[model samples]
Target: MTAHETTLCTLFAEVLGLPRVHPGQSFTGLGGDSIQAIQVVSRARLAGLVVTTREVLRSESVSALAAAARTDDRTRDRSGPVTPPRRFGPLAATPIMEWLGELDGPVDTYNQSLVVRTPAGFDAPAAERLVQALLDTHDVLRLRLPEGLAAPVPAARIPEPGTVSAAALVACVDARFATDEELPALMRGHMRAARALLSPREGTMLRAVLLDRGADRQGRLALVVHHLAVDGVSWRILQDDLRTCWAALASGAAPAPDPVHTPFAHWADLLRAEATSGRRMAEAARWDDVLRPAPAPLAGVRAPGPLDPETARNTHVLTLPPEFTGPLLTAAPGLVNGTVNDVLLTGLALAVLNWRRDGDGDGPPGTDPAGGRVLVDVEGHGREDVVDGLDLSRTVGWFTTVYPVRLDLGPTDPADARAAGPALGAALRRVKEDLRAVPDKGIGFGLLRHLNSHTGPGLARRGIPEIGFNYLGRFPMGDDRAWSAAPGHAFALDDADEGLPMAHAVEVNAAAHEGPDGLTLNATWTWAGNAYPGTRVRALAEEWFAMLRALARYTAKPGAAALTPSDVSLADISQADLDSFESQLGELL
Candidate 1:
């Protein structure tokens, strides 16, 4: 390999914590996701190699990326610190408006939490200072949700320097346990209390608790923020910034202010404008069809209505071990020019169809009467490149867009292994095309549905899918063992309030985490307990896994993964022509 290619390979290996990376190995194939892609972009810039996150996603191999990378810094010096938009009064973001429309009960449980092991030698006092600094720095953290507002027009105030400390926002708990068995209950109690302390109305949007397990053991730092204030990407920014501030404080120096970020309030204003713009309004009919017909709850739902917090909820977790996960995450996605999400959804489509056909009581009986179609509400990180001068790379807030997608796999049959191989491959390709066909990663859907008066009401009345799926990207195993998620805490962010309403009948949340066990894909299947039995959910989960495993195995064969027309954005060829060309070219080769 050339020197440039070798350097790029090393960066990928270091970022992904792999033993080594060859030029032919693509980033996504090695279990890299959007977060890792950003890290690569940062690390490459520091290494004096110019590679954007877009390039990282587009190029198929390290060699291709190296060849395209610029040696000089022409593009590097073209940018400057982005000044945040001026402080506006109350503003509403797309996701916030959608959330407010669904509000039916107590707002206390509508928060997100993250518990991480504190840095070595870090005390509670230092942690408290760090939390205060974060609250002062991130505008969304200081937002106030006044009462009697139909829409969630959250107002945020800029705190003067040295005036941002709220003693009640930070608490230290003594839970020095000798064994790990007590950690779960202890952490849960502290987290629940911390969550209760959060109220947007009171301008108390964030609370931090440090679980002091003593000097001999690493402590857990629990952070709870209102969901309106943070999303998946925001957590990444907060985690990195927290560590940055902690390191500064540890060295007896005040942390410097972060590079200017596009404020949450600014983005919210843009969304409101974009929601009513002609561009978004033009896409209204497309979105209307997507959410036109909501699927019925699985054939045997005990209660046939929307789920609520009062209803009992249950979860079933299924895991794909590192071995299968390796191919499933890397090679399988490469075949269809797809993402891990596309592959998983393909398997889910087949599983739902087959499970229902078998009369397992989890799916429609026999064949799907809708001709093998299932509408699923999919979530996306809503940092789209729609605006010309906007940069949300480091901004923090709830930028999630939940939109509906209909997976149409046309009358699938639950065949034996031999027949299923071909069937699964075809389903994967079809699903990828369906997802690629979505407009702007489903960002505009929420805008038209919530912000535009003309389209909002109709979109709202169209109803939502019974199922929801969110692929929360990959969390690669890094060397920073001291700062990762604290082990032995509660499974979710916070024990959701019992009074909170369930948005979907069934929701599947999947994320791949790298650890000593290698890459393991863990999916949590959550449902309303009163509606579906645990046994039935488990059966559906198993079927989904079976289909995923089949896909992984199928992709292991030669020429299993093929590029359909959708994979080539500029190519206007039909699928049939592409298939014929591949076959003829294979014979010649």
Candidate 2:
């Protein structure tokens, strides 16, 4: 192999945890995902090779990527650690501003948590030191919310870590669990106590629960952090940092994890400017159309009520088998010139339309999902490269954006598996095009609706979708021995108050994981129980999975996948015109 190819293979093996990677081995085929791809690109840049996330996915193979990779100094610092600004101040680009305005809802539930195992001999003092280092390293972990949103200086800020106490930042508790079955209930109890322990206004946003088994057995550690300071990507960063800090502390060296690529506070300031930019203001009208109320009431929905944790919230889990998931994540995307999200959502749109059509007509008094349109609020990572010289690959915070999307896949055939092939293809094309039309991956929507002074009021007055969709990107399972996800302990979220209102009637959170079997996509459907029957929701979930299965089978055929007009940025052309152009070009060749 050439020099670049050698470097690419080494990076691939390290990131994917393989003994070695051959030139012809595909990236996705080897279980690499967009999340891992970012790490590869970052490492490659440090080695004087410029390879982007897109290139890693598109070029798949080590040799192919090496040939396409170029030498550049522009991105050398793209993944390096970033230091805090000299002066800590308020951040205006707060995406949670709208949520903060709801005074009655419980703020404690708005948090994410993870449970992992600590190395042998890991105890209280080491864990405490690790927490202090983490708070000092990531500025967002030290964020403070004002007592009231109406306060004069209500914007959140990251105070210098020197003045903060690690013990105060996160409440710590140590307990013992004798067996695996006892772990779940014990973790649940700790999570409930966290509701009282975690307070954004008090700058107490984390709760660390240490689970001890026998001294011979490895112990478990749970870190529950408020959503304001973390997101899905941020967890991976924390895991890496924790491992680094643990090793350093074990060796009697001060643990110094990677620096922040761009501080969350800095990004907040940039978003404040971007929200009121002339370009964003021009998008006000387009957003107005997207947020327009649905023509008909959603199927199986009763009069909506507040998002209650105890009575209203219900969950149904759905999965696509590993056999189908492997292709869906790798080959299926290449077929349609899209990403896994596009294909997965295409299945969802088809299932929703079909389920509504086949319903007992017992839907609330109007046409179910009128005119074959399904309105959904989609969640994004919100870390777009909108601002030059700003990289958020390592930054942590609740940098998430929620925007509405209308999946308009005109009428299709009823639910007949044999004849669903044509409908699947058409739906894929329509949904892919719809997502492509989202401006800046839907980042500006939150800004205009909540942050912009001129457009905020008008956008806020518009209706929100009844359904929400969030696809947490695919990730590899626990491979690191030093600090990996706890085995047989599933509890991860802090318990929310029962009286808080939900944002949507139903919210779908989907993620794919590589397991011993292969890759599997798991989706959890959470809905307000009072508004929708559990039986009906389960039926809908089954329909969604069936649609995904059909999509996977259809794409397995020869010549099933082809580029659509929206896949090209050259000019606006209908699918028919593009198909004709491809046919002619093929004939000439």
Candidate 3:
């Protein structure tokens, strides 16, 4: 490594609290997220290397950043304590946030939960220290969700790490947990979840615990925070930070402190300004016609069930087989000009269409979703680079983008294994095209609806999509289990939002989990049992697999499929059209 690279390596090791960092390691690969990127920029400036946070984020790799960093005579001090943002501003309603305000029903249940059972040797103080570091690192942890637009909520300043919170200890005589049997909502986490779920107010959005099961010496360490404070990407950075902090604490070394980024409050101020601006209003008006119609309902697969208002959602879990999993994920994306999300959703659209045409029309009143096209509530990470100079990739917030997607599959034949492959393949192609046709990946829809400064009657609210789709991408945790140093420390981590509620009628979550064993794709469908039958739900699951199988079969032959338009290629125009245009130009020449 050159002198610059060596300096960066040392800086990252010190800032991130790692023993050492590889010169070639990626910022994200080393568990360094966007917030940490700001710290790096500030620290580098102090060291006389004037670099912007955007530069650090774009560089990603340590070696690249080192070469990119230039010493400026205008640079300030070499080092100083990370300070909290003094300014306060309200963030405009993210699509999900605005929708949450519109709903009169369950808001407390709106949560995101992750549970991990680690070995006994893990200390409570270590865990507490880890959380303190988390709160001190980002001010979003203390962000309060507003009840309505009656008033704006002021942003919270980041408190010192040592002063954040004192770890709470509670005793449970025998903590029996099982994945098969359904337990009472309160019994789930016993400590971390039950309390937070019961009363999930602002300033107390997150909770952590050290659980001990009698004298068994086997314990579980847990951290449960409301969704408003974290997202899929945020969790990745938090997990890595926890592990690093714990290691430093255990080894009797003072943890290297993280630098403060462009504060969430500042980002919120900018978002609010952008949302109400004339430019944003024009942007909203532009999307009025594109998303005017709502998605078709899934009333075709409705089943009879009791209307229990309290118990609404049911979760069904499915794992793809090992043989087909890897190939399906890798092969289909290239063939269909899309992603795992596009492929799976296309199959779902086919399945919905198939069910509508075939299932007994036993839907409740207005529940009939039979149509040639289907609409869905799609969820994106909401990290769109909408504003220049803003880096949200590593910022922790409920940065989810929810918008309607209309998939026009035209028509489908009745369910037949022999014909399923071709039919699914066609639907996948249509889905890729329909998705690509959207402007800026559907970012404008949410901005117009919730954030635009001016709202005209031109963009009135239509009914929302019944089916919600979200792909969690992948789990940050690898297969290497135990957190403790000892051999007997059995450990397991899981992502869950059970007993928690969503605004949508049905939500689908899919994630690719990498482990010591291999890659496995997990699909979780949660629905209001009263609205849909168990039989129909099972069938819907089957349709997703059918689509994957069809995709795999079509791509089985060498050169059977072409790259998806999503893979670094310009969209809207097809290869054949471009080739024909070029040929005509050649003839004219």
Over 112-198, each residue of candidate 1 has an lDDT whose tens digit, in order, gives: 877787764667788777887777677777776566224435543434334446477888877675355676568778878888777
Model 2 TM-score relative to the real fold = 0.87
TM-score per prediction, in order, is 0.88, 0.87, 0.71
State the lDDT at 119 in candidate 2: 76
Which of candidates 1 and 3 is the stronger one according to lDDT? 1
Instruction: Output the lDDT of residue 462, model 2.
Output: 77
Query: Which 10 consecutive residues of model 1 have the lowest summed lDDT?
Result: 295-304
Q: Give the top-scoring candidate (lDDT).
A: 1
| lDDT tens digits by residue: candidate 2, 1-589 | 9999999999998877678999998676666766677678766765778776767866857889999998956545667676554336675537665544542576654678788877756777777788888888888787777663444443566688765677654444445435656775776687667655777777776778766654566666788888778877777778878887898988999987766657787788888888889888888998988877665545222233465443433888778898788777667766766777788777777767766766534464223546667777888777776876565666778787888788887765635432446667767777888988898888888888888878877877776676778888765564436577775544333244556566777778888876566678988887776556777778778888888878778767755777788777769688767767877877898
Alpha carbon deviation, residue 401, candidate 1 (Å): 0.7
Regarding TM-score, does 1 or 3 come out ahead? 1
> Candidate 1: global Cα-lDDT?
0.73
* Candidate 1 wrongly placed segments (more than 4 Å): 1-11, 20-24, 39-52, 63-84, 148-163, 175-177, 213-216, 294-305, 310-313, 360-365, 416-420, 476-480, 490-495, 529-534, 569-572
